[model samples]
Target: MLLYIHIPFCDSKCHYCSFNSYVDLFHLRESYMKALSVQLAYELKRFKATPGSIETVFIGGGTPSTVRPELYRPLFETLRPFIKTGAEISSEANPNSATSSWLEGMFALGVNRISFGVQSFNNEKLKKLGRAHNADDAAAAVLRAEQAGFKHLSLDLIYGVENDTKVLLAHDIEEAFKLPIDHLSAYALTIEEGTPFASIPDVANEKLALTEWFLKRIKKRFATYEISNFGDYRSKHNLGYWEHKDYIGLGSGAVGFLKDTRLYPTIDVQAYINDPLSIQSELLSEASIKTEKIFLGLRSIVGVDEQILSEKEQNRASLLVKEKKLIYENGRYYNNDYLLSDELALFIEQ
Candidate 1:
């Protein structure tokens, strides 16, 4: 089993972000962590989590670094008995908020990995993205994490924004390689509804050729595990999601999955604090579950199991295999090129 904890607090909201995070809710940090502990207790019973059953833990957010480590200690203490030995514990951080003391504190609490949201190494691009940290601050924060004894470090980079040239992207990749990070996530800019960027959708400006070129540059140093993710050390928590493992999502704005049911707690921080056990559940049909597996499998190294396909879908998959679009081995079909994963899944389903 895997676990995810959400921290919906940020110092500032990015122009292009639509995640359920708030900048004004900083006052509720303490109350929110307390609420999270309440939810954790309920979910432990609901998910039937056994001792040493949790394989990985990921703390994502509005910005996880905004909260002090002491605020997180209660949750870790409760989870310690259920976490497997040498489990991967990761947290998402921002360069501006992830101070030296913060990094040391989290490391001392058994968080061995840090995934920094260092979207770019160019100051101009950073401003365009409304990022809180400049290029230098990002570099310094990452070095601090390494100095604090983090064994695995990862950072994110964004591409396909307006005025993204090969020279600019190449420089970004070069700067990232200089860091001691083993994992990198390169995402193309996409306009999401209800975001500041939504008013000016053209700011995204993705060019297919440029995106492919940028990915190739990063792939030179790290291996691509998914279309947007590359790393020498793949994240077990990330792979767990693609593999459809059962996970308990703690906190507001978080989603949890078990068997065929999806669980959601409230998105409002205040409401969640009042009653953390007030969760909504959705059931997934078998057909929908199978479809999800196919799409997820084709997008990463986790290939689709042959037994999950119908006879008609199997025939279509065989055709793709014959045409060199997929590789069939060990009773599973693997995608050779992640770019065509969606199209391939659609063809098989159709």
Candidate 2:
């Protein structure tokens, strides 16, 4: 089983961010964390997690570094017995708030990986994206994390925005390689509903050729494990999701999955604090689950198991194999190119 914890507080709201994070909820940080503990206790019992059963843990957010290490101590203590030996524990941090002290503190708590939200190394792009950190701050923060003894360091970069040139993206990749990071996630700028970018949709100008070129540049150094993810060290937490493993999601607006059911806790921070156990569940049909498996498997290194497909779908997959769009190995069908993952999944599904 896998575990995911959400921190719903941020230093500032990024204009392009539509996540369930808040800048005004600073006062409720302590109470919200306490509420997480309450829900976690309940989830542990509900999930029937055994000792050393959990393989990975990912702490994502608004920004996990915004919370102090002391605040995370109790949760780690509670998780210690359940976590397997050498489990990968990761946390997301922003360059501005992930101070040296914070990095050391989280490292001491047994977090082996740190994924920073360094959207871009270009100061102009950083400012336009409403990021709270500059290029220098991002560089320094990553260096600090390395000094803090984190072996698996990762950072994010945004691309396909308006005025994105090959030179600009090449520079971004150049600056990223200078850091001591083993993993990188390059995402295209997509305007989400209710985000500031939604009003100025033209700000997101994703050119397929540029995206392919940018990914190729990064792949020259690190291996591509997924369409957006490249790493010398692939994240076990990320792979767990693609493998459709059961996980416990702790926090408001967080989603959990167990077999065919999806669990959703309340999204309202105050309501969650009042009653963290209040959750809604969605049951996935066999067809829906199979569809997800196809999409996720195609998009990543994970290949779809042939046994899961119906006879008709298997025939469709066979056609792709004949066309050389997919490679049939052993008893699975693997995607050769992740760029066409969605289209391939749809064709098989249809």
Candidate 3:
């Protein structure tokens, strides 16, 4: 089993973000931490002795580093009793919010991994994304994290912005490589509906393709271990999700899958705080699990088992193999290259 803790508070909202995050909710930080502890306790009791080891615990969302360091003590105190030894406890931080003191506090609380959200190194591009920090701040944050004794550091970079050139993308990657980071997650910018970036007229199909090429180049430069995620070491927690392993998610807007049921908590903070047990749970059918296994399995570097693909699917895989898009070896299929195109994967699967 794995665990995920969602911290849904950001210093400022990014233009392309649609996650259940809020800005300037500092006043409610204490109450939110208490509510999270209650939810964690409730879930722990509900799944008593399920016979599994938690290999990883990822604290993601809004911007976990934006939360007050003092408020994190109780939260980590509640979790410390349950987390197994050698578990990778990671937390996400935005460049602007992760201060030196904040990193030290998190390290003291047993957070060994720090993933920074440094979307771009370009100052103008960072502004366009409405990010709170500039390129220098991103570099400084990583240095601070390293100084705080964080060995496993990861940085996120977005590629293919409008008018973003290949040279610019290369420079961004080069800057990230200079940081004392063990992992890199580079994502192609997608224009999701209802985001500020979605309404911008500059976002074009050609720009999207350019972004894709940039991502491919990045994968080549920094060993792509998974689609959208590349690093020296793969994220064990995220791998659990791709492999369809069980996990417990705690906090508002969290989702957990356990014992054939999928539970999604209310997105509203107040609603979750008032009724911690008020979760929308559904019993997942076998077919649902099977479909998800195939979909998610293909997304990872570790490809699906040979038995999972039908004869027709095998033939499609063969076509991809011929096209040099996929390769079959050692009774498994892998993308011919490191980069896994979602559209191409869907086409091959269908």
Compose the digit string of candidate 3's lDDT tens values, residues 1-350.
Answer: 78888888889988889888898666677788888888877887776724335667899998999887788788677777677887898999998889999999999988999999998899998998889999999999999999999999999988656768888888898899898987888776778778888899365233656766777766665677677787777788878898787778888898998878998988898787787678899998976776676556666777766677778877887788788877788877776344455655576567
Clashes of 3: 0
lDDT of 2 by residue, 179-240 (tens): 99999999998899999889999999999999889999999999999888999999999999
What are the TM-scores, per candidate, against the unseen true structure? Answer: 0.99, 0.99, 0.91
Write down the worst ten-residue block by lDDT for model 3: 336-345
- Candidate 3 Cα deviation (angstroms), residue 259: 4.2
> Model 1, range 170-253, lDDT digits (tens) per residue?
989999999999999998999999998999998999898888888888888899988789999999999999999999999999
Model 1 scores a C-alpha lDDT of: 0.95
Please report, in order, the local distance difference test score of every candidate based on alpha carbons: 0.95, 0.95, 0.81
How well does candidate 1 score on lDDT at residue 131?
A: 98
lDDT for position 316 in model 2? 97
Show where candidate 3 strays beyond 4 Å. Answer: 49-52, 204-209, 318-324, 337-349
